[model samples]
Target: MKRISSIFCVALIGCLLQGCEKKIDLELKTTTPIIVVDGRVTNSSSEGSVVALSYTKTVKSDNSIVPLTGATVTIQEGNGTVYSLPEVSNGVYRNASLTGIVGKTYHLTVVANGQTLTSSSTMPTMVAFDSLVAEDFPGFGKTIKVVTPFYNDPPGYGNQYNLSIIKNGKLIKDVFAYDDLFIDGKKATFPLIYSRKADEFKKGDLIEVVMNCIDHANYKYWFSFSQSSTGSPQAVPDNPISNINGRAIGVFGAVTFQKRSIVIQ
Candidate 1:
């Protein structure tokens, strides 16, 4: 009798567990497409200002963007001088005549599909670096060499910086930005952090460090964009706020570029 009771209890429990299982199908939400505009005007005359236009894609779709063509792009200075940017390639526009000038504000306007978008940015003064040094630093379980650039923060508040590292003429994708909030009016040094050992400088590798003195808006965009890109648990991932007006998603940057190069010794 005890064995029969135990067998009945086991059967009852198995039937209850089987009854509780169900499959759930969730409905995914879709959104309308938003226009994306990425354009920049730099102080370098040789490297002209360029703009690329595209639209957002759905989450379920393949991650390919459709490049927009036949759009009219123009840039204007604060003094009302306008330069038209011609389409060089599909969805890409360039204006070699629109060289960025320090302390001058630049305005960008784009007309596409009967919609207009606009943005403005001011080119900040260039901050000169003192020197670039490659020094040996203690790493995890070993010593490694890193490249650092030394510069004095200009004697003012609200100064922002963006740094880029190029190895053998290719730009690294690491995003580096700094603000003079705490280190105002002080000499600062920054380390170029690379992810892989293969990216580290060799004895004779040519490295170029390009620094841009950007405005506050540009600094905010880069800082927020980097945080969203890192996939951090603490970060609230969202699109970086666009400097452009209208329902567009992108930035119009006017930056001053200064570069320093060094061969690893």
Candidate 2:
């Protein structure tokens, strides 16, 4: 989740800002390599689906990731339609014509190094927001404009949402997810959190907020990921609860998205 990444980035920036000259050596423990898969299928016909493959490294390594190549990846629809994704470059497997439809289940299969990994997710219905507005929040040294999106929760249980904020065509490093546990079948006004540098929106900047209707499994994946990544005291420092089987780390998400944009005034 973006929240987890944002927290890590803030901590790293703080350490750099401290201007410490002393180099501290840490005895990093070596661990076995695990396959990381970030695969997604959306309802947008113009957008292609991709499955990125890579191997994790130790903390003491040179911080370079080795891409997993020559792998076979395929996605199967619930109606028995299977599409194969070929390796293009940079360890990425993509299929340009495979578009997900709402209320349909999608299954992902990967074969690499004699190992097979698979996961399934169902695409939920798309929920469009009613409106979007920018609200000014007075801070210590600056005024921050937080984007607020308004939407009505559909009359049903098990509804989950994921908000993605884009500034000037670039996605911001902050994850926003919500569930209608208490406010089911009600109008919801969710405000975006802007606590870090990467989350701040400026005047005259183009901002787009994308709301995704995700299933319960995808919601749990992201919620647990955000908690574990942020080093929450309640959560143990381990890999987020993965939906993928066969020791792979990452998620296979099938989502429906509705987006709206506004230029900051």
CA lDDT, every model vs. true structure: 0.72, 0.73
Quote the positional error of residue 192 for candidate 1 in Å.
Answer: 2.0
- Writing each residue's lDDT as its tens digit, candidate 2 over 138-235 gives 75477788888999888876677878788998877566767776557888876787446655787899999988788765665555555544422112
What's each prediction's TM-score?
0.77, 0.79
As for model 1, its CA RMSD to the true structure in angstroms is 16.6
The parts of candidate 1 lying over 4 Å away from their true place are 1-32, 58-66, 138-142, 196-198, 230-237
Name the lDDT value of residue 235 in candidate 1: 22
- Model 1 worst lDDT run, 10 consecutive residues: 19-28
Whose lDDT is greatest here? 2
Best TM-score among the predictions, by candidate number:
2
